[model samples]
Target: MAVAAFPDPDLDPSRWVPLRYLNFFRLVIAGLFLVAGSELQLGHEAPKVLVAVAFAYIAAVLTLGFPDAARRIGLDRLIMLQVVIDIAVLATIMWASGGYRSGIPVLMMVILAGAGLVAQGRAVLFFASLATVVVLAENSWRFFSGRSSADFLQVGFVCIGFFGIAIVARLLALRAKANESLATLRGVALAKQQAVNERIIRDMQDGVLVLGADGRVRQANPSAALLLGVDSLEGRLLAELDESFSDFRVRCASADGALQRMRASGKLLRCRAVGAGEDGEGGGGEGATLVYLTDFEEILQRMQQMKLAALGRLTASMAHEIRNPLSAVMQAAELLTEEKRADVQVRLVRIINDNARRIERMVRDVLALGRREEALPEALILAPFVASLIEESTLGGAAGRDVFRVEIPARATLGIDRAHLHQILDNLVANARRYCSGKPGSVRVFAVDAGGRTALHVLDDGPGIDAAERLRVFEPFFTTHPKGTGLGLYIARELAEANGATLELADNAPGAHFVLTGRTQP
Candidate 1:
């Protein structure tokens, strides 16, 4: 079995360019030195100088030309070998040409510059110390061999000058690196803070909308879009998009922190504006304002539900307290009718009958609150059903002859309980007939198939509900007329909702319009 060779740990394969460039410059310099030495030697042969130049060329090729192949064959370790060989070649050239007086010691500065550019601080310092040792050793050797004192002084000054320049350059490079590291750290922290703020904004359940000073919607989260019944709210003005919300105005002062909540359409809307701080300005002035919107749709719904529950409880208590007196009045009227005085008894019976009927209507309205909704029956074709209801109600004198008119498409069908449906229609038609008494009015019932659902509309030409009264018309025991129970519309709405249908007051040309819409089954 053959053993696999391991990679060299000292060499970085990715960083070959700097090393290659350094070696190429080294080879050029060494070639110049070899030519100069040969010219200065005159008739003498400078074999050592020639040998040093050859070795420098070989070192350059080893460092630059074959980094990848050398790495594959475990010759990558020879990079350090190449550096050592270059240093040796410089030393040999110095010794061959007048030792310290050859000006070859100046090459140590090039070596130090290379080390600083390509290697770490400790590595560069080590190379600098090694070059210093070589210079001192060459000087001592020359001195022992009887060289002049002035030559040693010249070499010492040159070495000290090179060392001082190296120290200053290294200090500046280190300071620059420290500043860069701090800036990178600050950038990372700022990115994390922005991410956190985005997460908080997205996770909010309440509809949140951010607007600019020009009243254009800058940002809207998913909940906000859903609440506003829009696909996307960005780049739209609040007043332009929604007819209900308009003329939004608020003042924000950086000097004082205050928030105001505005109420509109029975819903509370909270808004806040934040002004720019002093540092936000280009020249240290205040910055732009950011507006935040918080919708209270859910809050308003809860309040309405609570009010309805309270009213339900009050009506239950009132019904119990009034039933006993109503029963006594009805019984007293029966007793008075049995008396023999015809004229007095006749007047008393009329008064008793009128009051008794009023009490009975009130009791019936209160009892509707306690009535449980029945299950839906099978689907019924709408045209025939609506026709039958019109004929029966008309014949029953609820709406007198020719008082009610109906128009229904023959193909329309609806899933509903026929009994409850009839009851709802009866109440509406009866209420219309009663209100239209002594007035030239007509009741109209119409039906159509709308998007796979059946829509039934009951319109009366008696009186239309005003905008102010429309909202309260559905409340129980809240009637516009003295004889009206006010429970008719409320019960109609409840029955419609129980059958998975919705009853709403629609805008009519002239009169009250009540529309019911629900899915139609085949």
Candidate 2:
């Protein structure tokens, strides 16, 4: 979260830094020319105007340029101008004092080295070549004017020196530019990859906790905070999150990677902790334990659903055998009522009827899953539909209907199949009636308009299913009731989806709650 401290990889050299080096070099070289001229006193025939011009050029470069403001004033061109002026001033001072014998060309060599350090590949060679031209022109004039000058032998040696300096300086400048560019690109790439990694970890639904060596939370995702029922856990001790996790953490420290359960608040969480390996970023678990937290039944429920989906076709194929036999058994049981049956025979017939009904429900659920029906939506006034459903179910002698309560907006509407919607409501109502205690408002129906959709909730006042069991409530053939065929919820969800709606189990502790969300009119 402290991302602001990360350094920017694409570094740019400060304009003042390079400019200070250039200006300081030029000023000092100009001063040396003046001092050397007075000390050597080698000037005899050359005019003093050239020395004055050189001094004026050096003064102009130093006084008029502000290196700190180089960004606004084109710093590269300014540096190039300084190089050109350095060449011209060096030539003027050499001609005015002593053209070939002044030993001032060594100073010119310093400028060449500085150019190689700061300038581009060709720029360094360009500066050195310009100096070569200036030196040749100044010495030629001295030779023609009958001033004390060296022969062709000395001139050839100086030309060779300038050639070698230009070639070597250009190569070094080229290499430096390549290395600097490579470093900058690598930095930018690293920053981008880090950003992507952070985004992925943040968006994950499973709780992620990073703990220090002392078992204090170093970093935690929002899911981790919610799983442990804490507002935040950045600096909290891991033992404080859940006392049940102490043994789990100890086992994890052994590096076995076994899953463990931790009971926190009213929920149970399945967790696994991983310590940093020897080659990991933490270098052998001094810090940074990656703990993954998830509800145990939730993970198991998902795995079961995946298995159910693959077996749905096979179950549907078996539905034909299951359906015909149940119908035959129910028919035979009804026909047997005409006989003079004994009391035990009556009980046996009733048992057959009940079991047949359960088998039929299970087969219907399989059919619904394997052959998914396409949705057919129609707009309907929501408040009136809910009122009618309540009235009809009550008049039909639905047990526990008297305890039902309703809350819905008057102007609500939904676009869905009426029959499919009714089926979903029937399942939820039956579920509520079976579970709600004999108390007022024990079964409540509420609808909320969420702009694009309406959420219809059915709540019951009873000991709610455990958090782990709640995750598998909608799974086929998964139920705690010995007489129940868990397909009621599975079929209900399928029917809801066939009408462009969704069925969901809501996490409402101390009570059971379900929601059926359907799209509303635009």
Q: Give lDDT tens digits, candidate 1, residues 1-522.
A: 011133235555223444556666676665566565566542133566566565565556444445455465444344455545556777677766666666666776776665455554465566666677787787788778786423667777877765665565556556656776788799899889889977886777656665655667767777566555677888888777654345444343333323334322333445445543433333212333444555555656886898699777757855764575577677768879687788878777776776677777777766665443455555878888877876786676643656767687777777877776887888877776665533333777789877888899888876687888988888776677766666778878877777788888888547888888887962
- Compared with the true structure, what per-residue lDDT tens digits does model 2 show for residues 1-522? 111122223324533344466666677656655556566553434547545765786676655355333444455665677678777777766776678777657777877776666666477667878877777777787789887776767766776687677678667756766887888899899889879977887887778888787788888888788777778899988887777666666565444345555555455566778766633347325666778777666778897898688677557645644665577677767767765768756776877777787776766666665444555678877778876887787785545456788888887777777776776787788778778796767888888987679888898898878988987897766767776766778778877776767889887745889988888852
lDDT of the structure predicted as candidate 1: 0.64
Q: What residue pairs clash in candidate 1, if any at all?
A: none
- Local distance difference test, candidate 2: 0.70
Report the alpha-carbon TM-score of model 2 versus the true structure: 0.50
Q: What is the lDDT of residue 489 in candidate 1?
A: 83
Q: What is the lDDT of residue 198 in candidate 2?
A: 74
Error of 1 at 121 (Å): 30
- TM-scores of all models? 0.41, 0.50
- Show how many residue pairs clash in every candidate, following the order shown: 0, 0
